[model samples]
Target: MTELVRLTGVSKRYETTGPPALDEVSVEVGTGAAVAVMGPSGSGKSTLLNLVGGLDRPTSGTVEVAGEDLGRLSEKRLAVFRRTHVGIVFQFFHLLDDLTVRDNVLLPAQLAGVPPRTARARATELMDALGLGEKANAYPARLSGGQRQRVAIARALVNRPALLLADEPTGAVDARTGAQVTEILRELNRDGQTLLLVTHDRAMADRCAGRVVELSDGRVVASTPAGVSS
Candidate 1:
């Protein structure tokens, strides 16, 4: 399979004196693969996601996503790259409470210059697929946790990004809600959306990922096919 994401000897350090947040980590995610990054808190999972998403640059080494070297892009270009090629779903369900679900999902497409009619059509299709059609006219605060996360997922996918990066997607929801989210992610991967997810939830990893990378103390300790013990 083609490589969709590649990180070579990447490290991030906030200060010169402290230990690096990432310690010479190397990881590659192939096209159409669902990969889970699992680690304890402070194990550098978020840093890895940020680097891949172009939200932060490595202090050393390179991060390449969808064939573009993130470290080489200027901030403006990176923003464009993110809107055009990458989509991110956060643990907190970062929906704009003031906007209706349709608007939230339409925002990325609008920012990317998708024609309003086309963006609305795409948003409607995604919402229907995610079983969120009825909630499209509702505010985020009016939806359940699971519904809100589904809205976030719909928003992330509105741009048809080459890569989807989900950070602890189930962390803030109840167990039942998390299960629903897990199934949604699994279905998305089955439909060939490349996914790189950071999570502490083992069940989610096993359910949604074809492969898993384990991190410890800022370094990769193991990598295995999903459903195998790491």
Candidate 2:
């Protein structure tokens, strides 16, 4: 399989007096593979996710996603790249509270210049696939946590991005809800979306297809395939 993501000696620093957030990290995520990144809090897992999605640039080294070097792209181009090529799922399910479920899901497509009619159709299709067809017109505040996350998933996938970067996707939900989200993510991966999950849940990490890299004090302490403990 082709590599969907590659990080070569990537490093990020926030302040001159403190240690780097990411310390010379290097890894690869294959196309259509589900790779999990496991580490304690503040271990640069989120930073890695941001870099992969072109949300931020590394202070040193390189971050390449889908054959594009994120560090080399200008802000405007990066915005376009993220809108069309990458999807990000946050722990907080960043849906607009006032917007209807379908509207929130269609935001990405609309921003990417998809016509309103086509975007609406795509949003409806995704909602049906995610079991949210009945709740399309409901506000996010009215949904359960799992339902909200499912809506977020539907929103993330509305554009059919090649890469999906999930940052602690199940952090705000219960075990059952977390499992449901995990199953949905796994299903998406099975259907050919490359997944890069940044999480601390051992159970979640254990279920992914690619290797898991564990970080400690801003450095990778271990890298192992699924089914093997870090």
Candidate 3:
């Protein structure tokens, strides 16, 4: 498979005198592949995701996605690169309360300057695939936690991003809802969407990813196949 994301000797430091958030880590995810990054709080999982998604830059080393080195892009160009290439689903569904489900899903496409008609079609198709078709006209306030997440996934996918990053995707939902979201993510991966998720949920990691990379104290301790003991 073709590589979609590559991080070589990546590290980040918020405080000049303290330990780096990510310490000389290197990782790669290929096209149509799903990998889970797992670790305890402050273990650098979110930091890694932020770097890959272009939300933050590494203090050292390189982050390359879709062949573009993120560390080399100008801030303005990085913003455009993110809008065009990366899709992120936050732990909290960041949908606009005032926007309808369809509108929320279309926001990214709109930001990417996708044609309105094309955006509508893409959003409609994603919502339908995620079983949110009927909720298109509904406001986020009217939807359940799971429905909100599905909408977020649809929104992340509106631009047909090269990679999808989910941060604790099931953290806020009930068990049943979490299971549903897991299945949704599994299906997305099966359909050839490259996925990278950061989660403390081991079951989710086993279910959605083919590989799991474990981190501790800002360093990668192990990289193992999903469902295998690390």
TM-score of each: 0.99, 0.97, 0.98
Error of 1 at 4 (Å): 0.4
Q: In candidate 1, what are the lDDT values of residues 185-205, reduced to their tens digit?
A: 999999999999999999999
223 in model 1: Cα distance from truth in Å? Answer: 0.6
Tell me how far candidate 1 lies from the true structure as C-alpha RMSD in angstroms. 0.7
- The runs of at least 3 residues in candidate 3 whose Cα sits more than 4 Å from the true structure, single-residue gaps closed, are none
In order, candidate lDDTs are 0.95, 0.90, 0.94
What residue runs in model 1 are displaced by over 4 Å at the alpha carbon? Answer: none
Question: What pairs collide in candidate 1?
Answer: none
State the number of backbone clashes in model 2.
Answer: 0
For candidate 3, write residues 1-230 as lDDT tens digits.
88899999999998999899999999999999999999999999999999999999999999999999999999999999999898999889999999999999999889889999989999999999999999999999999999999999999999989899999999899999999999999999999999999989999999999999999989999999999976
Instruction: Per model, state how many residue pairs clash.
Output: 0, 0, 0
Summing lDDT over every window of 10 consecutive residues in candidate 2, give the lowest-scoring window: 208-217
- Residue clash pairs of candidate 3: none
